[model samples]
Target: MAIPLSWWLTVAAALFAIGLYGVLSRRNAIGVLLGIELMLNAANINLVAFWRFITPQALTGQVFAIFVIGIAAAEAAAGLAIIISAYRRRRTVVVDELDTMRW
Candidate 1:
């Protein structure tokens, strides 16, 4: 029995929505990053699902997915480094509280 594309799409949509909510509602920097990761994962799922259903012969979709994963990893590393530096300077990881960026 094969699964349908709609099912995969629906799941991705839900995951993306939840991630968006997390990003918008969270005050902590780490929480926002986690939301971003979830969104990225949702994107990955969509890409793979589409590739599997639309063109299983082509590897482009998987290549793109891998690229996205690489980018996400770099983003996470840089984001964490910045967050850690900010926390060391300000002692808080709350986004609204970090106002040092404002001129």
Candidate 2:
């Protein structure tokens, strides 16, 4: 079975758009982090799809995806730590309220 490139791109684009909206509209630090993660995942999906349909020679996409997953994990960990620290300092998780960060 084969999948169409257009369909895959469409799905990836939708996911990226949703992530962008989440990042733009959400006010919580965790929500923003989640949006960023979603955007990264969407990018990974597009990269894999392109490699599968267009390249089809090497497993570079898979390797790239693995690296992306690792990076995303690290990003999530760091983002969580920052969010927690911000919450501790500001007593709020709202993005707007984080303007004054005191460590």
Whole-model lDDT values for every prediction: 0.96, 0.90
Best by lDDT: 1
**Model 1 TM-score on a 0 to 1 scale:** 0.95
**Every model's TM-score:** 0.95, 0.92
Error of 2 at 80 (Å): 0.4
Q: Highest TM-score: which candidate?
A: 1
Q: lDDT of candidate 1?
A: 0.96
TM-score of 2: 0.92
Candidate 1 off by > 4 Å: none
* Worst ten in a row by lDDT for model 1: 1-10
Q: Under the 3 Å rule for N, CA and C atoms, how many clashes does model 1 have?
A: 0
Residue range with the least summed lDDT across 10 consecutive positions in model 2: 94-103
